[model samples]
Target: MNTKLIAALSVLLVAPAMSATSLDLGYKAYTSDTRDDNAGAYNQPFLKLSHFNKADWGTLFAYVKLENPGEVKDAQHGADGKLTVKSLAIVDKQIGSSNHNLWMQNFLVSNRTVMEDNLYLGLTTNQKFGDLFINAGAGINYSAASFSPTNASFDGLSGAAAVINARYPFALAGLKHSLTVNYEGQFGRDGEHKQTLGYDSYGHQLITTLKTNLTKSVYTKLHLTQFDSWGATPNDGIEYGIAIGMSF
Candidate 1:
C-alpha cells in the first residue's frame, strides 16, 4: 500500500477509540457528463466509508471510496484499481487570548489508479456568517507521486494549495436540507512540470452539494462540480450527479 493510504487507514482504525467518534457507510451512484483528458467520461457508482472524530485537541475525518466496483478497466479506476483514501486532521490552537477558530490542519489524499499521492499542511480558520459556516485554509502541498516510476505521476513540491468550504442549512416544507460548497486549488508550480503533467500551473476544483434527508438515516444528494484540472490530465468540465445514502 502507498504511504498515503496507510496513514489514512491508521487514523481510521484509531479514531473510533477516541471520544465522540461517528462512523458512516454509504453508496453513491452518479453519472458525470464531464470528460477526462485521458479517461474520457466516467459514470460508475462508488461506495464510501467515512469516519469523524472530535476531541478537545482537534478533529479528524477520514474516508475510503471504492469506485467502479468489480470493473477492471473502468475509466475512473485509481492506484489500488478502484480504491481512494483521504484523511484530514485539524489541531486546535488558540492564536490569541480569544481566537478559538484558528487551527493547524493536515490533509492527505491518495489514489493509485489516478497516480496521485499528496499531502498538505497549513493553517485554517472557521467562521460563521449569519447562518452560513465557512472554513478556509492555505498551505504547502507535496506530492509523493512525483517520485513514482509511472510516467504521468505528479511529482515533487507541487505547489501551494488553498481550500475553502462553506455550508448553509435550512428547513423547507418541514424537511431539513443543507448546501455545501468546497473549493481546492494548487498554484505556483513550475511551468515545465505543468506541461509534463499535462495540466495548468493552477489546477482546481469547485464542488457544490445539496443534501436532503428522506428519513432519519436516509438522505439524497445532488452534486455539481467544476474541474479545472486534476492529476495528469487537464480537465475543464462541469460534472453533475444525484445520489442516495443512509447514515448511521
Candidate 2:
C-alpha cells in the first residue's frame, strides 16, 4: 500500500466542516463456482472501506478493498490475500448544462498481479422519467503492466467500456427503499484477451441491487451479480452479498 497517498487522501477528506464528506465500512462474503473447474467452489470474505468528499469540481470517492479467496479442494493453494485501492471523481453537479449529467475520472491499483492497476476517464449522465432513474456512460481504460490481468497479452493494454444503470425508489415502513439494475460491457484488445481466457472477449456484467434505509442515516444493501463469459475466462460465475452502511 502507498502510505503517503493514503495519508494525502485522508487529509483531503477531513479538511473542514464545509467540505461535505462521508465514510463507509462494510464486509461481504461470496462464493464462486468457477473455482476448481466447477468441482467445488471458491469462497471469499472481503473488507471494504469507502470515503467520499464533495468538492467544487465534483465529488471524490476513495475506496480500499481487501479479500482472500480459497478453493474447496485446496484452500491453502489460493490462500493469498489481495488488497486494492480505487479512486473516482465525478464532475460537479453545478458545472453541466441540461444536456449532460456527469463526467468522471477513475484509477485503480492492487497489490496482486492478477488484479492489475488501471486509469479511466469517462462521461456519465443520469436522468429521471417519472419514478424511474436511468444512467449511462462510456470510458477508456489504460491497464498498467504491474497490475494487468495475466491474459492481457501485452503491456499497457488499452480498452473501453460502456455502462447503463437504472433505479426505482419506493417508500416502505415510512422509509426509502430502492431497486437498482446495472450493466457494463468491455470492448477492445484487453477484452479480446479476456475472451481467449474463456471470458467474453467483449466482457459484460449484469448486476442488481436492493437497498433500504434502516434509519435516517443508516442503510442496508443486497447485491446479486451475473457474469457473461463467452468461453474466455476460467472463473466466470455468480456472486451475491449484503452490506450495511451509514451516510453523514
Candidate 1 local lDDT, 48-111, one digit each (tens): 6665665444455655555555644355554223444555554443345432444434454445
lDDT per model vs. reference: 0.62, 0.55
TM-score leader? 1
For model 2, the stretches where C-alpha displacement exceeds 4 angstroms are: 1-32, 37-41, 52-62, 68-95, 107-109, 145-154, 191-200, 228-234
Per-residue lDDT tens digits of candidate 2, residues 1-248? 23544454454453333343334444443354445453222354555556556644344555555544231122335554444344443332324445344444444434434333444457777689999988777877655433144444333555786778799999987889999998866677474445334444465668898988888778888888776541122455676777777766
TM-score of each: 0.74, 0.68
Instruction: Assess candidate 1 and give its TM-score to the true structure.
Output: 0.74
The count of backbone overlaps in candidate 2 is 10
What TM-score does candidate 2 reach? 0.68
